[model samples]
Target: MPDQAERLRELVRHWELRRKQTRRTIAVASGKGGVGKTNLTVNLALALKEEGRSVTLLDADLGLANVDVVLGIPTTYTLAHVTRQEKNWQK
Candidate 1:
């Protein structure tokens, strides 16, 4: 029932109280294709971001990496770019 700003403040307070380094890794994988893994991952990232948590979505499907396609964003950099040292992970 709280507004966005209030909810974010609550999250900030919660994090401040905890003050512990917490990290989570979620992987969406299925033996079959066309199972909406990318869609679910993208939605989860968006929801986490809305909750004021930093989210990074990495599509490791080297065969057909299409997270950018689902997000409708042009791919300017990728894992290859990072590996090649052309781009850094912070970017």
Candidate 2:
């Protein structure tokens, strides 16, 4: 069991190293709403993209999703749709 655990730890460390070399990830979160968390996230993504960094913004706020609205992009699908199998994320 200990050997297996050590192997898992080594695998995790290897993947973590690869992940750091690949790209950066940022998560903007706040316990309170209407505090501009979404706004900041969108702006940060735009700034990163402007600097030639690839950016993919995910609006995880299912209850009060406003990232698309703030960015002036209409959403035909959401995480809920994906969860319900109504839409495929790859599409």
Index of the highest-lDDT prediction: 1
Clashes of each: 0, 0
Please give the TM-score that candidate 1 achieves against the real structure.
Answer: 0.70
Provide the lowest-lDDT 10-residue window in model 1.
16-25
Q: Write the per-residue lDDT of candidate 1 for residues 1-91, one digit (tens) a residue.
A: 7899999999999997675457788988998999999999999999989988878899988678899999999998888888789988886
Clashing pairs for model 1 are none
Instruction: Write candidate 2's Cα lDDT for 1-91 as tens digits.
Output: 4798899999999997786579767899889988989889998999988977778888887788888889998998888998899988777
Estimate candidate 2's alpha-carbon lDDT, on a 0 to 1 scale.
0.86
Error of 2 at 11 (Å): 25
Score candidate 1 by lDDT. Answer: 0.88
